[model samples]
Target: MREIRQIPSGSSLPDTQWQPPYYDAAPPPDPSQEDTWDVVRKIWRRKWLVMGITFGFIVAGAGTAMVMTPRYSAEVRVLIGLPDPNVANIEAVLRTILPNSETTQSEAYVISSREVARKVAYRLALDKSPEFNPALQPKEGWWHAVSPSRLLKELVALIAPKRNDSAAVPTADSAPMTEEQRLEEHIEAALLNRIEVTPLNRSHVLGISAESQEPVTAARIANTFADVYIEQQLMRKQRATDRANAWLQTRIGELQQTAHESDRAVEQYRRENGLYETKSDTVIAQQMGTLNADLVAAENAKADAQVRLAQATPRLNNPGDVDSLPSVLQSPLIATLRGQQAELERQAAELSSTYTSKHPKVRDIRAQIKDNTSKIKEEIERIVRGLRHEAKMADDRYTRITARMEQLKRQMGQSNDMTVKLRELEREAQANRTMLQTLMQRSKETVDQREIQTSNAEIISYATVPRNPSFPPVTLILVMATLVGAGTGILLALLLENLDRTFRTAEEVEEYTGLPSLALVPIVRGRSKAPGHVVKKPYSTFTGSLRMLNARLSLANENSAAPGGVMMFTSALPGEGKTRISSSFAQLMATEGQRVILLDLDWKRPNLHRMFNQPPGAGLADLLNGDITPEQAVYHDPASGAHVMFAGNVGRFPGYVAWIERLRMLLYTLSRHYDLIVLDTSPALLAPEVLHLARLVDRTVLVVKWASTPRRAVSSEIRNLYSVGGRIAGVVLSQVNPRRYRKYGYDDAGYLNPRHLVHTAG
Candidate 1:
């Protein structure tokens, strides 16, 4: 037994508030910024689960590929040829087409249409084939009852409301289709599903692909589509040509009738009017033309005569003036008279100048001049008379011509009405004859076209038998399954990791609780109750862990007022190895020549006495009540050289609230004697008394069973201790599984089971 010695008054610990070193604890790294190796390690920790899932997916993929049916595909390429436009500018709607993108797509649609599908189905007798027609196959077996599709359909039926849509819909003759028709339709639908029509590169060429169990049948089906489509096109063109010819023949007869009627009417009209097809104009028109020309000439003559008379009449009062008229002056007799009169005048002027006015020569010349003037007048008058006579003749001729023209106009008016009617009838007959000739020519062409019409679609390439199946791509499925499996496994591992909220490493404890993790104690499997691992293997990994814990506590107390401080071991919940850890620490301290007392203040569940292999005894309570001295009351452990104080008659242990001061006094008295005192208290959460006890101790070490204690409970207990002003030194990750701990990639437990070559003499 350790001897009790006097303790100085200053040996009592100073009242110091616990301040968690916030800066020492690093903030958790962002998950995105976490190291890649960290993620790898986390996944490696759950490798078994991941590998199992991956293997399951691989097997499923291989199984699915093996079970799937293989289908062979064959392609038939057909080029759609546009029909030649009609010479008559009348094109067949289906035959003449442009090869535009829309046209190509439309051709593809035609190749895949229900009509084409039906034709292909009938040609192949698909309705009688077991593959295309379900009705032709044997009845489904009992396995069909438990099929996923069947069960899902049954579930949907149960959940869905019953609808009466037949009453709201109309039916032809209120009758259902016959079974054969229904079967054919079903086969056609199935054929359509198996057939794929694609307008390759948006061109006029169409690729018709068909899938079947038999490679030969696939090729046959594809080829049959092209044949049926072309044949259908030919049949349509022939029908169209026949209809066109019939219509043309009927129109020709109608045109003949119209032409005959028109010709007869024109002839009858011509006979009634006594008309002939001599000229466009009539005899009255010719007569009128002659009269017009004569009338114009006569008018011109009469106008000239009147103009001459006008000029002569104005000057008739003076013969000399009349002689100045253009007509009179033009006459040869008037010209002669003017010349003689001028000569006579010249002779008279010469006589007058030579002799007296009464002279014989003057008298003679004057008389001659007078005689010539008289003759000129008479001539001028004659010319005037001629002009007047001519005017009269022109007037009479104009009047006769005008009278004749008036008669001709009357005749022309009467003939014009009959001519107009004749021309209209003749035009109608000519139009009917022209149209009949065109129709007769077109009818001949239409009748001939039916024999030589070409198909709009031409098969550019024939389909050949395929050599391989296209469905159930095994390699691709296996690869995808592997990828999906790995992804799912990693996802589930991460999900479970996130869900588990436990302290896994010292860093995790420090980061979560804002307290320094003092140590990592490897789990001593099956020896947790007593920590006997510290005895036989004194320098093993387990003892080394306890040494680390002891060193940290010693270092913490080095700066504290009391070097020999009281440390209480406690945890959030029971069964966290707190008692074991406290006992082990006390025994370790004693072995190192330190006077340590292991006190079992957990009256509710005392375990220190059992760890020392001792029975019931008076412990701290008896010592405090002055019932026994330290030597008599405390039992010394021989194995570890530590003093033990078990809870004596725990039923007599007083109320925690009233006994807190007593417990504090007892700890101080033990502190004076022992170099260290370890109080093994009950779980902080299980016993509220632990919180009161925590404040009396110099430092409180929280014992957390690694990966077993929940983080929230640790945080709650820490808060409780903090509220009571307990000095929490740090945390201990107790009972750590070394393998899993290393998997976390934390090297804090590197000293445990290290892989190294120790060169020591055997």
Candidate 2:
């Protein structure tokens, strides 16, 4: 005898502690709660696809860089110094004569100017050089090789008729440009595009560069441009100096002529005025000078005479007081007489003191004093007469000189008018002479400085042939292409994922259908001879998935009053593996020591008998037609340990409504004996019979194909089943890829081992 282990109707484990291992049937995840890892896992699963796209772009970019024409750049450095002070001085005199206003900046502009470009092109004959002329150079790039322009040109050339080579005629009406003009224009345009000028920061240096297909040509063009610029500067300086010199010479000549005329005018005025020179004295001037001296002497003599006359007149009243008169005091005779009289008076005074008023000594002294006084008076009269005569003579002389001085003033006034005209002429002549001298000095200095004038720019370095091309760097292009390709691939992957409307995980089925998921069944690669995979491969992942599904179903049954219930398996569409799942599930329940029966209620397309390798026989249809009892129709599948009943020629039964009622009766009878009865019905979406069967069953399990079934289709079918009052236990995702299943956060490998279950022998 063998003992069988059976799972209780009521599970001891809590729902939170132990859920079905195949699927997490918890409430649908919050829509707002985003899963970043889920998106990352999707991208990671498709990483190889992205890497392949990136590599393709890299290869394409590398090929493009390889076939591109090589271009080289050559640079020539120039040192621009401050404007020469000499040149600046010349510019002051002749404004706009020099082009060295701003040292480095102006030079850079000049180097990039069209005139300089034309000059450089002409010097190098760039119009004839293929390097400068795009029309002259051969087309040599991958784009050019593949271009339609090349093909068109070739085709046109082939189609056009050829003209006679030797007898070409020239048209006189055509105004074609001369070779010189053509070359000039071509050179100008070529140099303009090829040349670049940049000023160095905070320095008087400029970089003039040229780019070309050939290394040597680029170097030659740069150096030639610098040389041509210097030559142009020298030519401009020479032109300016020549012009200044010519102007100075003309001005100097004019000044010399004016100075000569001024000198002649001065001489003519001197001769006309009877003046030897401006400084020579005139006759009136000489007479006035002599008269002025005589007048001064006469005035002095008059003053002296007046003083003598005044003294003499006052002394006339006292003739004996001759000594008071200026003339009398000067005479020696008068002085002697006064002395004798004074001595006599002294002796008489001594006698009178001793004698009476009439004493003989006193009377004799008085008579001597009278005689001396009379002699002094006579001398004073003589001196007064001499003084009067001398004063009158001085007055007459003063009067004569005054009359003569007045006459000379009239004559000198006439000479003054002539002197003013003479002075004006001399001033004009002197001014002209000074101006001429200044002009001559300036002209000489300008001539001396002309040869030393030079531009404020020089070439500090010359361009050399470049060794490497500057365009189409292969490594950089490839790296950029790789990054772009990777980004594009990732975006494409996400876009496709959003457009896909299939269920990828068990959570997706539960969320869309609003039902808990019973299990996640992996795709079985090889088809089994027996449809019951849970019995044939008990240790496989498929068997484990079935076991988990049975456990979930058992728990549901335990919660209900009907422990042994009719559980029907159906899908949204045909070929969702519902039939196989139903058969496998019943076998799984039987293996756990439960009395389970598998029924094929899909009369429209019955396939249960084929799954069990049983031939066509009496099944549920035969019982409803009263041809056989339910016990006679039921067949035991020893391999799965479950009884199977087929549809058994359901076409013979014409009344489907009555058959549906009989089917319900059949299920009720089976439920009395079996712990679980699984009915494999037609897809709810395709067959109308599925809805009837759904109402008869205790529970309805919706089977969905993983990553293949459309979400809308599954959802619609579930709704239809529910509309009929069907008891929807949960959903089951079938045919899931195990490798991809693990990525959904479920441990698919953990359920593959069946070692946890011990099989007892009967």
Q: What CA root-mean-square deviation does each model show from the true structure? A: 9.1, 10.7
Candidate 1 local Cα displacement, residue 479, angstroms: 4.8
Cα lDDT, model 2, residue 397: 90
Candidate 1 error regions (>4 Å)? 1-51, 81-95, 145-174, 262-288, 297-397, 404-434, 473-487, 526-531, 535-540, 558-563, 603-639, 646-652, 657-662, 742-753, 756-762
TM-score of each: 0.75, 0.66
Give the Å error, residue 515, model 2: 3.9
lDDT of 2 by residue, 164-201 (tens): 32112336875776866665666676566667888867
Q: Against the hidden true structure, what lDDT does model 1 obtain?
A: 0.77
Candidate of highest TM-score: 1
Task: Give the Cα error of residue 2 in candidate 1, in Å.
Answer: 38
lDDT of 1 by residue, 231-343 (tens): 98778888888888989999999999999999999899877886655466556677778789999999998898888888778788875576578987689887888899998
| Candidate 1: pairs in clash | 523-736
lDDT of 1 at 460: 89
Report every candidate's CA lDDT.
0.77, 0.73
Q: Which pairs of residues clash in candidate 2, taking residues 3 or more apart in a chain or in different chains? A: none
If candidate 1 were superposed on the true structure by all CA atoms, what would the RMSD be? 9.1
